[model samples]
Target chain A: MPEGPTLAQLGEGELIRRLGAFAPPGQFDDDAALLGAALLGGRPAGDPPLVLNTDVLVEDVHFSAATMGAADVGWRAAAANLSDLAAMGCRGAVGLTVALVAPGHTPWAWVEGAYAGMAELLGSHGGVLLGGDCSGGRQRLLAVTALGRLPAGGGPIRRGDGRPGDVLVSTGAHGISRLGLAVLRGEALPDLPAAGRERAIRAHRRPVPRFDAVAALGASRPAALDWRVAGCDSSDGLATAASCLAVASRCTALLSRSDLPLAAELAGQAQAEDWCLWGGEDFELVLALEPAWAEALVEQLEGARWIGRLVEPQPWGPLGWTEGGGPIASPTAAFRHFG
Target chain B: MPEGPTLAQLGEGELIRRLGAFAPPGQFDDDAALLGAALLGGRPAGDPPLVLNTDVLVEDVHFSAATMGAADVGWRAAAANLSDLAAMGCRGAVGLTVALVAPGHTPWAWVEGAYAGMAELLGSHGGVLLGGDCSGGRQRLLAVTALGRLPAGGGPIRRGDGRPGDVLVSTGAHGISRLGLAVLRGEALPDLPAAGRERAIRAHRRPVPRFDAVAALGASRPAALDWRVAGCDSSDGLATAASCLAVASRCTALLSRSDLPLAAELAGQAQAEDWCLWGGEDFELVLALEPAWAEALVEQLEGARWIGRLVEPQPWGPLGWTEGGGPIASPTAAFRHFG
Candidate 1:
């Protein structure tokens, strides 16, 4: 054994917090780092800011051969990073690079399938595969770095931009991906129909990055607000996303349980509400927008739901219930890597 | 066992070649991918192209606890990616993101030390840590994505840009890192003095990215020749670098054995020349430039040496020897992943 506390003792969140000290302060506060003229220094004024997001998926940690095929594994890895770019308000990605590590005994066909899957996704979206590196290792791992450009003349929508009166909206339903994972694992879900089960499995296997939501948000932005929307993806669950927004913006997020956008397939399921609040890898955009803009967006955009609102900061933590009017306990910790 | 062909059967190069089909043509030919207005569709004319490189370092495969501690592993991982950026002729990096994977039992102190090493290198060079991801894995791994920008009005120094008459120059000596690795492995070398052993050990542990050579090359470029220098870092040894340049440029590289820039530390060592030609992890640059400019740079840049020249393509392969004027056998393949 080594001399100090192991990563399991600290957990992923704490480990990330500790590691954040090595980077520029506040650079890790958002889904992606924005490299703008201000950051690069001496760039021309009209050039759009570049958004970068890196996500790593490891075998047995993020995927399993038992549940996900090589293609699905590749799709999820790319989606995770592209979702981060979307969360940072990029309309589309410029390109992505993949750093892959696999054991020597791994199939070349598997590697080709993964790249094909990534190509399929990028073809549907608007980016190309740039380049990457490969190495042999004990376990299969994929680290994807996605590069995107913010819309011309548009500022990045940051987590810290939420205001007390901003309305919280979810771009689409949650719990579907969790249901999909359960289905793939052969779990019994009595309330879910066969079609619903298939949808859930597909959702888990190939979660879309919600660029449509980003477009809707951009299109619905009131001129006065000037691209000040605040948002993040619900990859770590709704509660965590809300908490992050609230904490970063120094306000309290008041969510209405009745307004939670649980997937139709999960209706009346025993763990539906729980999954809606805490299920990971949903890949939906959770946004805090001006009240009027949120109303317009929800009415105009399919599946958009007004789920919550931001309130004045309280002495307690950043999460609260709109109905009970007090702080809500944090959701059960999500699936942390080392926990 | 799982497929028709395992990665080991095809080797890293063939695997990469197959993977290359999924990317845009010619994107993977260089040390780094250059994303410019042409590739990205509609960037402003004045904006410089962005250069991106991703490098992955796996424990046991890329580093071992026997030879490298946590800090050295991190330093080498970061250096490898930064060297790619330097090879692309970037004066410095914009920033880099690290995707780290380690076991749950990994010491938190080890993780901290690794990040510290990366910070130290980035501090000495010119980039900041933008952001990164962390996960639990069976083996420790680091995937770093480095971002840089081509100089305003300057083109990327591509491997394919060598001209027939260009003289090949090496920025500094090679083989020190290979010697260092041997020393760390407890190999006996009577010819190497204690000082040489210490230097070799240091070289292996913390090889610097030759951004200084990049700067010198930039400064010594003749206005008539523009920025048309063809180069790559000697991370995979001099022979591999020269071969890559020659093959990519469709010319034959005629190297003079008498002019090889072997490290002074290995002056009388029996394997000195072999190490200089075939040893990996030497981060010095191998560049092909116009003869006049090469001579100017060799004089202006300390430790620089004119090692060879590019010649007309032959019916044989791209390598040749100046002494005999016939094809030179390809140096034994360097350390390749999955080989």
Candidate 2:
């Protein structure tokens, strides 16, 4: 074994970057990988690109049976993959395959509940359940592969399409899910009103993918402006997601702190800013689009919020947060997969 | 929990069968689930059906690091999924996505080598590694998804297409992988020669998918006969796989004990029959075709062995083994996920 930093020390981003080096170039650097006839630019005119994305949720590591129910685990696992498809602006997932690994002593009802949860979600999104494998393992593991279709004429919204002077808009809020996580962890949300607390908890339990939002935005965009839309999900926090988009597009995102859509009940919480900046599990999409089109899109969508703008590459880094002044000090925190 | 039996008691097959009943029908019954435009049987006139399959390999349960190298684990994981595609007579896979869950202390070399093994196997089959997610878990888990494309004009060969009087063919010798597993488990194989032992170990360690063989078989068939080709991999042993096919097609499989394509070295071994009938991990495909086509196919493909014939529903059962006389006593054993 080669001596080096452990995966916990290297973290998810660096580990993925190192593993990506093992694969051929241009393979693992996308939100949802585009494969099949779509690999080449010519997809036979009418054939839509097939987008594939997978996510695995492990017992204890991703969720605890004591804190989370079996159905929620299954729903969240499917949602995580669906969000990846949403990042690419895919219309909707057509196929869902789930593989479950669990202990032999596991309750049969838990397994059935999990599949029921997945079925319910798929039914709502016009997705169908494909065949999957079942196995016995020491711990419970759920792996979901969501197969989606790109729009016929409109191309997918990749993370590397943001250009200088583009407007950065975010769909919905970011910290609600994170706040909900805190509450789920039994942390007291004393400042939050009852309704806000309930809403945040639900957000954390069932994070919805932004597929409908992206579809509406894509439909309202002008033909020439379609190609410039760049976006990715903020599952790893707004900071990391914004930085990833900026780095991929070779530009800088100057986010206005005041423009963030914070829940009203979180106004008195001191950690609200921290939650918005570094909290994870928020499935909202952060997108960069041409300025005029972004404005039009925001107007078309009910609650789309414009919070930042892309500019020339910055010397310090790809992300800059401003609060009615020059860029504020950077926040170097985000959810870590391993600790 | 509302359960008559735990997952362990129900075993993998019964558990999956019961769980599958919760979802809408027509899914989870095929080797590779067909989705998207393929679901409707109208794939834009010229496009091929999209075939998707996922397989999960768990540490200790599927492979132990002490017994198997990391590369072998990765290779076998991918081969499992590819075999599912071959079962459907899909030409080849286009995209491969892998989700890996391992302890944070896992060596970087192990992960890299695993990816290398997957890359080498995929390179030979014209498949590319798409993006996948990585996370921390208690034990090592690898989930592989191989997306394949059926040949244009012809549809997928389903498990339920086996007709009465169709001849069943085994792609290669069985029990090789099972014997390999025994050897790896430190069991004494006194009768096996060094060369045979090495071959068995290779079969278990780095099993190859039969994509090329299935493609050739499907290609050689006449257009109208293509859809009638029924097949599936014998990962769950010959008896179980044949029984599954029979049950799915509402027919019966009468297997000839003498006609089984057992590895030459495995003959005369006390456990050879048991391994051939119930030893899992054999990646060879079992195909059911019309009697005349099956004979022609065996001639066209070198080393292909005719094992049995599918017949109309029989009173004895869906599966029976004959040894030139009356049906022999059936073996009730198979590789179980939980036993």
Candidate 3:
């Protein structure tokens, strides 16, 4: 008999690794797989490639109906899918398809609110809910499909494209959504300001994708396989995403602890760094760019900050955290699906 | 207080109708909405428009774990989405996105089999799984999004395009899948042949989409706002789909009782017509075309059969059943999500 850890013990990453062997080569390793890489025939040059992604939110797994509203559920699901487009630096989302499964007794207002939330977010981002399916189920579930066009000139920025000396950058704050979830889940903590709690809750409930920020980079032309930048959405914690980038690019990611941008509301929190490292669901982009272009690119985008740098693979590890002098213990904590 | 029927009583279609008011006009009424109907700017003329559709399947509601295998679940879900594209006469499917949510205790083999089934079906249909999200949930659920391309030099044939003089046609047999399900569920029967039962079970377990049959019609040119045909997938029962088309096109559907192509296994079954009318999940295309073109279309496509005709709206109803003599009773039964 075979002896091995179960899926929960093996974790989401391991399961993905095992499943990767069955998928088309080099396709399922990124935030979203590129379609038509070999099938887009007769399409005119300059036609933007279509980038598609899907996300599912289960009632208890992703959000508890006891705490989160239906509108928030819809908004968060859309945001998750949109973040994948941002990871690829797609021009903007053009359309979305959704499937909703819930009990027969579920309120109509809840569903209406869900659609309103989807429409509101997509409209603001220049996208729309084009079509969807709804079915009755024992539990509430929402699945969203987002479709976007790749930038006219630039191809997708993949995790495997990071060079040895690329500067690691990120957009927006980290660990905020996780902190917000803690607040919403009623995890008791030291005396905290009511305003801070509200802010954190809002952050966890509503995340904005960095599509506009990445769209700005689309002006860069693709020539001879040289990309201006490479990255993926850091929804699965900074450490996990960075480690994945490291493994894919065959480089070491030396992430800086002091350079981390903690959420404003998480000040004085003891495990703030821990959350920043492995508290996933941040929906921020962890980008890698040439050191020479980092400063100029940061200047062009808002809320963009440099956090670390990619270097030659070290024998010790592929991921490392450093403060000032030397690398400290690497954090193994990450939000895995089964875990 | 202002009240009529709640979502559960009004059912899925009514809820969609009420919610459709909030969507872009006529967009939510079709199998797949056209994204660039008003936004296709700078896009070359002859480029095929993208067709998108979504379907969700949940445990207990869609299938029972005891009866259905994981692969069957995945294959059935994909077929549902692909059938939507076939309803629109899309040239062919190109890509798909899926979301799977299941508990940690679920067997890893089940997940692998699910993927294998999806890959096998999509590959045979000229499509590939692009990307998807997987998470841990209380109940196993699957959602699929299918993306296809509209045929070159042709526009989509919408359900609302049916004319009063049009003949109603369907690809393949109806009620066969429902009979198959009954067999799988071990419903008591009148000593039906084992071979016939096996065939019905296969139909229910592995339904195919009519993409090729519809693609053949797209070769016909679109001129002066006239179209070759209009229809939708009969996942909601033939009666329900026919009624929807009649409502959309402002015509009455006059269905012929003897014209229905029932499965050979149900030849002597007294309840065969009931299953054909109300037992949904057939995944067959129910098309409406002009009388002049129906003959040619049947000749071009295998297993194509004429089922009914459209007539001017009568005072009594928008859908009617008739045989060699007087009008028969209309079927009020439909497979509703929340019914």
Candidate 4:
């Protein structure tokens, strides 16, 4: 046996906590790293900050050939990083660099298809392919680094900027991607409608980054608030995202069970609530905003819903949901790579 | 048997050539991508250009625990990307982002040691750790994206900027790292001195990026030429680096075998010349300069050697060498990932 603790024993969160010690303070606290004017010396004031985010997708671990094509793998990899940039309030991407490693015996067509997928996504979205490196390895992986820029006069939406009475808003319903993965995996979901199944699978394979939501928020922001909103992406599920925001802000998030956004297709499904709360890879924006701003934005933005509120820390924990005026237990555990 | 072609059949160069079509024109044509003032909008005129390079190191492919410790692995990963920055004429790094993928069974100590190594390298050099992502995978890999900056008044040293009459200069000797690898592999070298063996091993494990050499070149540069120098690093052996420069510049590089720099420890080794010409991972700069500037630089910079000159392409190929006033065949092959 190994003499020291293994990654499996520590879990991803603990590992990340320890690894944070090696970086500049709070470098890992945000959804993406913001290289502001201060970091980028000699930059003109009002110039947009550069936002950077990196995500690594490994074969078998993140995806399988049975579930998605090489194109979907590439699209998902790019989407994941773009989603992080959006969470950090980037308006558009500059470009991205991909570091790819694959087995020698991998087909050339697969590589071509992956690039095509990335090209398609970038064409529809806002970035170009900058450059990258390629190498051969036993297992295939793509590490994508995306560079984005905030809009003029916009500021980064940090995770720790929430205040008491801030409203928690979710940009879209969760669990769709999780359902899509299940559909691709051929799991038994007899109650899911055919159209729902199709939507879910597409969501899983080609989840869109929530840049549109970011645009809506920016447009609907109250003049008084300026960019003081707290935000994160629900890539790790709704509960986890809310909890992260709450923990970072030193507040308690009290969510409304009835107000939780649920996909139309998932309305009558038995397991929809559980999946909505805990299923990963939704890639939707979860924001903490002043109540008036959140109310106005939710009214203007399609599919946006006010689901929770921040308050002083409760004795129980950082996150909880209310059902018919009583507090319900919250699940603290989130997705862990090692676990 | 399964497809039209595989990565191994295409090799790294051909694959890169094909992949280049997916990126912006000339994105993959340099050692690192230079984001100039135009690309980074609203930047001041005197501000430096940002240089970006991403390199992926896979376990058992780029490194093995049997040959080096985890800390060395981390150091090497950072060094490889930093070398690319140096080759592109970066004065200093902004920072680096590392995307790491490893198995759950990996010991926590290994991760700690790796970060420690990166910290040590960054502490000595100019960058800080920015941010990164982590994931679980079957094999361990690190994709490091290094961000650097060109000097305020300097421009990028592009691979294709060489002139027909330019002289070729090498920053330092090559093949020490390759010899170090051999020593680490326990290859027998009866005539090798113990100190020489130790030096070779260290060279392989802790190969330094030649930013120092870049600084020296910058300080010694003549005013007339500005920053028009052409250059590349000898990470893929001297012959390959020269050949790339020749091909890119549309000229023929005729090297002087007698003038090749050899390490003092390798003075009497039988295979020293062969290793010096063809061994990889030397991390030394190979520069193209005006004859007068080259002469001056060679005189001013320690261990710098004027080894060759660029001429019109010959019918045979882009690279050749002369020994005893007679032309000798040049090796065309370099390190390849899939091959």
Candidate 5:
């Protein structure tokens, strides 16, 4: 019999870790992080341009057909693809997806049903299906290859570029998806109010990308602090996202416990505050700005709020938590899949 | 535990008919040398463009660790991707691949080894690794998407363009892959003794595309026949390929049995002609050309021979024949999956 939490019970980290085993020649690209490792060796002695990222979603494991329909899968699939695009701070995607399914399982009706969900997202995002081949039976896997047009100025916004004193900023709050997962898990409402939990659920199920924030970053063209700054989508909560960006930028970001966005519903899951810090799938943009850009940064965003600042590199903890062991610049609640 | 006949027994017709559950939206371009339906949608509007195709090979079913070594699987995977590009008449692929696998099951060494195979193929074909993703997994899934630069006046070569007098030609012989499959099935090679059979085995294991044929077709540009002539790759076999092209073009094909290309070894497992006729995975381009260009094509191809012709519409059958008793222009065989 299937044991131990039926994938639904496992945290995202553990799940990803387990899935990592099957990955062939994998790196940070699948996680929406930049490819800092030199992709080219000694062909002509030129730096490699364009950060290539890819992600794949599976059925039953990622989403239950019993819970979300094919349309939801389709929509999520596009969202997932777009998240990779946003993670790199690039324009729209020239994406292609490979779908494998059981014969009768993927009848045209089901595929069309799935397309309807994808169309809902694509109608707004503007990427049409290039082409796909359908093969029968093999755990339906959707592999989306998104070709992102890198910015003309430099390249993809990477994490290791951040420096100390950089003000940490996130486009949105965290724990919505975690809360949503909790709600779907049939957990009883906690002491916190139900409204926030509902919002969390909505955010998780129908997450949106921070295209606007990325666009703003691109338009600002702040190359000076840009090298000292870093960015990546907070798909795996603020903390993981922040840590990833910090690693790429080679700096540590301190997140103030108070700043970690925590909705009351988080209490229903594990640690409400922790989930906000570490819980993932928010799809928000976590940015580290120079302290001097703090005021202007806040003004630039329609509703941007200051979070924290980059500090000397710390070996112990990740990006979202501070030195005192509380939430800081990144999400506190971490996601785990395996152990 | 595994039951049923080999994939060759299933045939290509049934496989496609099964996939018909998903109705593909398409353009009305046809050159009826019946084969699997060529999709016209996905690209720009009204640009009869050659298609770009790709596929993902996952561990377990597509190729298992027990039978295929990692490098073999890797080589086969690239071959599969190249097969699609070849089918589309593209020079080669210009993209990357995303491979997901279980971390413990697949070590860094294993992945690097597999990549060795990919690098080998790409080097030969001059394809750069555009980008790719790797993830830990319970099973290994390799998803590859390739980009192709189509010729100015080439795209989806209509299958319906063949006229009654148009002669049929293939880049090379078909059914080699099927014969190869027989060898893979542990059949002794001491069956029938034909030179073509050995070649067929190689075709199945490591098939190569015929760019020479493509160049010839383009350079010759035969226009003797009234109808618009077209060309497509025979993935399943000349039979099924001809069927789809015919259906799309709304025409009939009279395949010549005498022109069938088969290798020497037939007595071992299955009949050579039977296997070749209905065999799948022959990545050979089957061209429907005008009679006037026949000699020139032969001259261009040197030894390439004309095998059949286009005919008026009729049902496929007559056993070792097409359905209508229309005098057997030739006894072309049929390849159907699940028949």
Candidate 6:
């Protein structure tokens, strides 16, 4: 577009050839295009139906950059929030990355490693870096926007899709990450006889995103529920996710207090309630299924477990504690930022 | 999306129901979408034509978090990057945000201010925040990726678009931001005229994106030449921009040094050469056109002047300093950065 006899090289009023070169992942588009960099003192695109979501991660709140590897920081920076798109049943199209660099040069190796890690992650997934801004400051923060496609006819899996007696299932085991965090923080002992410390550690290191499993399930099975944003990752604890989901879903879940899955270390730390209910960063697929299909679905997924069923939303009571599991509220008070 | 359902409440299959409620955007799209988060893990929607650009701004590299208000930081962050998007004639569809938080707590007021600022900019422009990552970090850094459209059939605008006999025109005047920066630095300005200070400061503090202007110029007039990715930013200084543009454009520009516009105070501060070619952050539109259309375009853009015409590219003299006016070699010696 810029290399040819368009714009200045040609005269005004002459038909500028269409910029059909930069191919993006949006199949809906027909040609390649030229990108105008950041707002360059110009008019904006016309209003269109758009989706928006923003996330802010604070040190200690999200990750300790000091303790975390640079590459891990990069990977997590993109993956954590990207999971939201998947949960929304939206296909990611492009990425808008903003990295607020911290003061002092981050080692070239570290910076490149982080970018390399993120690039590898983004590349393997079919995403392109559209354009973004970079700056330095007190802390290193990253804001990434994942532009995605709404499945053509396929709708997004929304929170209001659960049916009465829908059997609850999760894509994989849970509580390991929370336990891993506890182990890392020295709050729990993974040194116990049954503790699989290595497994717990791996769980914390590189969390996997469930785009595949979710997409396959969406396309092949088409989770026929009324909502589309379906089956996204559950990195946070089950209870935390449930609290918000319950309100939107307008349903309650009752997990058999004893049936939730947990690693042996987590089970041992059950007394601390640091594993199953409150512990987070699980990053698994938690699902709601029709009661009729529960057994077969569980059978189909070897590692999956039926935790509870969706009931009516409750004003009070355990939403998943024991078939009456309502929500989690620490006695002395819910989880606080500080000790 | 999180507000409606718990993972357990609605299983993975219900995405269709939720997403179907919304309409898809016009243009390109494919079913295979970017599936994962780390380095592009999702399926492809199929490649569509589009434009892309990115930039990063930090608290210090771009602005001092200490003195600059959070709202200003946020406004500038989006605006500065949006400028890149505008340069390419791209429309912002989605964004990826990575905010590395500082130690302890940065007030919610600050966060709100930042989002409010960005929101105001994005809302007016018609873009959205899809999903991004957040983490704790040492210093603040922002990286943004912008995705845009190019009339359904646009090509990459490279620097090599200009040709000999082309006219030079910009959307607006130059050197205001430099003046603003000088003001911010509180430089001795007994000789500095007062008229240009406020405007320059505003230009530096908030650079409105040039997307609309570029689009309008490209659409209505259809640029005679492109020189897009091929060209750099005003932050790099007009001289460097001209040099690189002319070189890539494979042409030389006989710019009439006298005709170039400069803010009054800026003209008084230093050598006119600095303001003419080396001054930075002007955010003005620069054009090279055939002589015939130059007059018409000049009429279209009131403030523009006959800078110079294009000639064959030279290894050292893209800007025809030997022919007459312009500075030697000074494009800010590259933008300053702490890292």
Best by lDDT: 1
Tens digit per residue, CA lDDT, model 2, B85-117: 888877677768888888888777788878888
Provide the interface RMSD of candidate 3 in angstroms, 1 decimal place: 2.7
lDDT for every model?
A: 0.88, 0.80, 0.77, 0.85, 0.57, 0.51
Best by DockQ: 1
Model 2's alpha-carbon lDDT is 0.80
Q: Which candidate leads the pack in TM-score? A: 1
How close is chain B to the truth by TM-score, in each candidate? 0.96, 0.93, 0.91, 0.95, 0.73, 0.73
Model 2 TM-score, all chains together = 0.95
Per-residue lDDT of model 6, residues A176-291, tens digit only: 77666666676647344434666776577556655564555444442444332323356656665554345446677666666676655554554435466666676666666665
Docking class of 2: medium
Candidate 3: tens digits of C-alpha lDDT, residues A269-311: 8878888878888988888888656665577777778889988
Write model 4 residue lDDT over B1-339, tens digit each, in one string: 567789999988899999889988888898878887666665665677788889998888888998989888888888888999999998667788999899999999999988888887877776878889999988888999988878766678999999899999999988888888878898766688999999998888888888888888888888776677889998888878888998999988889978887777676777787778888888899999998789878888889999898988878788887553334454566566885
Better candidate by lDDT, 1 or 5: 1
Q: How well is each residue in A1-339 modelled by candidate 2, as lDDT tens digits?
A: 456777887888888898787556867777878764655333475666678999988888778876678888888888888898889878677767888988888888888888887777777765777778888888898999998877765677788988998899888777888788787788877767788888888888788888888787777787665466888988887877888899999998888877976755567787887888777778888899888888888888877889898888988788887554344454565446665
What local lDDT does model 3 show for residue B144? 85
**Residue range B167-193, candidate 6, lDDT tens digits:** 666656677776677677887655665
**Alpha carbon lDDT at B104, candidate 1:** 92
- Backbone clashes counted, model 3: 0
Clashing pairs in 2: none
What is the clash tally of candidate 1?
1
Given candidate 3, what's the lDDT at residue B84? 86
Tens digits of per-residue lDDT for model 5 on B1-339?
443433234343353343233323342132111112132223334332333345666665566665456666666677676655555555544445544433333444455556666666666764555555444345666776654434444443555555666677766665667776765676666644556555654566566655556656666655543324466667656666666655655666666666665543444454666565567677777666777776577677744667666666666532124333353332355422112
Clashing pairs in 3: none
Task: Tell me the tens digit of each residue's lDDT in model 1 across B79-186.
Answer: 899899889988888889999999999999999999999998899987888998999999998999999888764567899999899999999998999999989999
Instruction: For candidate 5, give the DockQ.
Output: 0.16
The residue pairs in collision within model 4 are: A180-A200
